[model samples]
Target chain A: MHVTEDDLLKFALETCDDAEAQAIGEHVAACDECRERLALLRRDIAIIAGVQPEAERIPLPFRSYRPSVWRAAMRMAAVLLVGFVGGLAVSRWVCRCPVTVVPQYGASAARAIAASPQAVTPAPPVDLAATSQ
Target chain B: MVYPKGTYEVSDDWRDLDQARHGDEAAWRRLMERHLSRLVALALMMTGSPEFAQDAAQEAFVRLLKANPAPEQGTLRGYLTTIVYHLALKENRRSARQQNVENSSLEDDSPSALESMVRSEREWLVVGAIRALDDAQRTALVLRFYGEHTYEEIAALTGVPLGTVKSRLFYAVKQCREWLKEKGVFKECM
Candidate 1:
């Protein structure tokens, strides 16, 4: 039977059984075209096998890579801190006090203010006599 | 099957994986040393970037450690490789999407001038050709060659049919061969 490229590749890779390998070997010895194809396949296989197998050492203590507990805690703390500071600023802004002058009243309202005990201001006794003089 | 009887020494792999899961530092180190390079190589083949491959490999190990009911024995390496493969695929897809949005090429495709200067080396050329392959082909070829897994194993790892794995590997090798020839690396052999 004529050898196919698949047969040649299998033979080259040594995946074929010994009997099939022998059969292909004998066939390739006689068939010029199959020999050429087998040679090329062998070359490709060699290149693939020749790759460097060395790799860098594994980083010690397999990094589990879970989110850090401390980082989450810090994030929570940050939020609370901002809230606290913001609340303090708002309370201070709301609690400020300022002085203002009270408005004067009309005649009847003045008499009522004179009669009230909480009104402690005494009118000057001679103010009307001084104005008349 | 069963690590091919004597191809590699993994007799203690199950024990080591058990210890690693339970917080044994030395066992974890041993496991990483034994499998890191291969995992990285597999990722590199799939993602076409050394940095991204390393990241994917590291992520795979981290996930392996975190997995409940950890993977069974004699299959840890395959399990890890499969994880790395999936991670690399996701990373590649995400980067591709971002590149599309930005109207920029993937970093893998835009090597610096200094990098271009070193393309003449045989290893780099081989790697470049491997990178040029589509994801399916690259995965099949790398698992078959780098991971040294059988087509059946690859089929199981990739969740595809046996026939599809075979076809992907066949075409992957063929494509890489053609690429090598076009680059004049294997012109004399052809």
Candidate 2:
């Protein structure tokens, strides 16, 4: 028929239910002292609940903010990729050796040219006349 | 007693979260709508700053959106809370360090006049009580009461022994009661 402080506190916090809660409720209704204790417990709970933590301004749902930086980065990457491909293509195309054509000579001409290598000029006409004389 | 209808919608928001994770912009917006308020509230309580709380909540959702989908493991809310808590704690440390530096700079002068004297008193009592608790107890109290996490979730999140979590919660509440009594808040009740 007596509700203790612990029982009252438990009841205040709703820690008790069913049979125990019913019993506490019954005692609280009948007993003046228990009623006062219940009132105090209610007050304490109220105070605890009332400790209004500053109204938490619900933050705006983070806008799906597309940072310009990200777009810029993607752009940079694309540019780099294009530059790399372009450089590769240009390097492949530009670095070939030019083909050269060589002139062909007749076999006799080649032989005459080889034989006359050391500074051939028409021999002086006198050389044949002198030989004949 | 039958609970009110729609009071416990099966949180289909998870589907939206999954879609968002898979790159659906519309789904991402819906996901944010469903959970942003709750996340902000939790973050505000944990970090005690509106700006920081917003940043942490936003960062958490962004992380959730970007993270690989793992629908089989848990609810998106749980995952988001975990991320927010981690980020908020990180921010708390940084801010605390900054505050320490600022406080030290003003150490030789008079106490801060702008601080809310009444609220600070109440906060000091609560924080002091919390400080008196062991790490496990303090962590459980913060996660459960401040972060609004369930016991099983707290245990899972903290990776602590479940029994340890239970005991820590029990003792933390007990300590809070005793501390409030000492402060005369619960004296009349006793």
Candidate 3:
């Protein structure tokens, strides 16, 4: 069987298992096509491996800074402001009081007054028995 | 494979990185000393300029120092390499713009015979071919060869899918091989 390019690449990369590599090695020994491809692949890999990026002498003690006190304070203040505003908005939305007549006005009279346009004093509370009846 | 064994006294980079994150000066220095060459090399390969490569390496370390919640996955070297790659890409774009501006005003922008001769050297040809590749392909190739990262490690470090990493390598290697062949660099001799 002809050894595939993928197999040759893997073998070049040393990613193939030993047994698989052995099989490819055996095939490559006999097949000029596979052998040439493998040779080119290895050469390409070597060219890449040969690249030496010139190194710079980084003087010890990397000059990096921690957040200054003022910056930290500012960040904290911003967080607190956001939290406060968010809490206030949430409380207003979730805990708003229901709109209802004042307690001095009975339910029926409150409804009557609300329905009418006339300006009048709130009615006294109705007796429980009367309201139930 | 990029980082030889015993190059670092402390083997676990994450530990040193963690310490550095917590304001340990020695730990930070250790990390810098260990990975500086690799990062510089990565940037050099990407940008093809020593000055930009140095700048990219330094910038990556500076960014690393400032990074809150420092990279948690992959080796520190891989993380630094990713940073260098990005910085180098940016540097390359900026330099390309400058070069274009210069070339537009010049009557003859083509390389002279001497320049071409020097560039036709094996190393120069390889570097040129590598630089000619798209950013994604170049990055995968560098990570695989220079960083010596496995495909899985490369995917994790580069934030690409494993399949994408493999595909990038396949195309990158193919392109390099074809380029080398055109240059009459590839031969039957193993």
**Regions of candidate 2 where Cα sits further than 4 Å from its true position:** A1-95, A98-133, B1-11, B18-34, B44-50, B95-135, B146-152, B177-190
State the lDDT at B114 in candidate 3. 18
TM-score of chain B of each: 0.73, 0.59, 0.60
lDDT of each: 0.68, 0.59, 0.67
Q: Each prediction's TM-score against the native?
A: 0.59, 0.49, 0.54
| Global local distance difference test of model 1 | 0.68
lDDT by residue for model 2 (A68-90), tens: 46768999999999999999999
Q: Write the per-residue lDDT of candidate 3 for residues B37-94, one digit (tens) a residue.
A: 6676576556556566677888877776666434445466666777787677677677
TM-score-sorted candidate list, best first: 1, 3, 2
- What are the clashing pairs of model 3? none
- In the order shown, the candidates' DockQ scores are 0.12, 0.06, 0.13
- In model 1, the fraction of reference contacts reproduced equals 0.28
User: Over the stretch B40-116, how does candidate 1's per-residue lDDT look in tens digits?
Assistant: 76776676666777678888777776663344444777778778877877887877433222222235344552144
Among these predicted structures, which one has the highest lDDT? Answer: 1
**Weakest ten-residue segment in model 1 chain B by summed lDDT:** B97-106
Candidate 3 lDDT score at position A131: 42
